[model samples]
Target: LLVALGSGGPGAPSPSGGAGAGGKLRGSRTEQSDDQRRKVNSRERRRMHHLNQALDGLREVMPYSQGPAVRKLSKIATLLLARNYILTLSSSLQEMRRLLSDVRERHKKRGSYSLVFFGSELHGEM
Candidate 1:
């Protein structure tokens, strides 16, 4: 996990080297390429750091916490599930509202009704 976070690990190159073409002078032409590569890496790392911070914030607000009680969800998985849940909830609310409106219209037209279960097979006659 530490290695994945770019914190520290045996495979990671030491950061003690100075940021200059001197570091890659073995191949003069490759020196500029190395600098460009480092710039791209640094930009990518910063972007990922910001994204991870946002994910951490999301985890905090979500109902579950990391423990034996509940396993921690990955950032991507949490976001996907959150989107699905919100969409489902919004759809359900809209359906309920529509049903209520339909029932009100029915009551106004026919005067009364008993047990009207919307969206299901359940229906009755007063």
Candidate 2:
């Protein structure tokens, strides 16, 4: 989305040099330009609203404090935290897969395995 910022209001000069045209044509073009400017501004405002909403949704799912006393995360902070979280999860998942592979290899060699959990033992054989 390319948006042209800065002032281009009624007092601004028309693109064509002012010498040739009559008053009616100038007035019409000015009205058209103003209308176009308004439409562009409206679209820009809507785009920003949607962007902020998406950022808010991201903040909601983040593992940060959500209490009223805590200030909402700034846009940069929200994005950085999300990136860090994804990297952490990716690393943890890789570690878990490696551990599981080791356990499976041990079970294959023994032809049976016992998995203990919370003071309980689960014994199984292939």
Candidate 3:
């Protein structure tokens, strides 16, 4: 049975080792290993499909819209762009919050006439 499994039938020549049953088993295992490799490749393709789906979703919500003609971004580029975009947005929000706080502080000080203005004033007439 083992010899038949390796060579596919009786009186078939084994590819490896001698004409013994052990050599037949090795040849059969080689075929099995090839099948396992194919399975692994298929799994990798599925994983890449999921990864592409996630990337497409990300591209939809990102600040810069991807053009139809644009090629797909690499994984590293996508991740880096996302990181930098988020950081820049966070910094902008923080700056706006700080400015708002300063405005509120100025408004509070205005009631007491403690705010000072040093810039040149715009004049309608000399």
Pairs with backbone N, CA or C atoms under 3 Å apart (clashes), candidate 2? none
Q: Deviation in angstroms for 119 in model 1? A: 25
Overlapping backbone residue pairs in candidate 3 total 0
Estimated TM-score for each candidate: 0.50, 0.68, 0.55
Tens-place lDDT per residue, model 3, 19-96, is: 545334556667788899999999999999999999878877776647777667777777888899999999999997
State the lDDT at 7 in candidate 3. Answer: 67
Report the number of the highest-lDDT candidate.
2
Q: Where in model 1 is the C-alpha error above 4 Å?
A: 1-28, 64-68, 106-126
lDDT of 3 at 30: 72
Candidates 2 and 3, the one with greater lDDT = 2
Write model 2 residue lDDT over 67-124, tens digit each, in one string: 7787999889989999999999999999978986788789978899887645798788
Better of 1 and 3 by lDDT: 3
Q: What TM-score does prediction 1 earn?
A: 0.50
Candidate 1 per-residue lDDT, tens place, 4-53, comes to 55446544433443333333334545577789999999999999999999
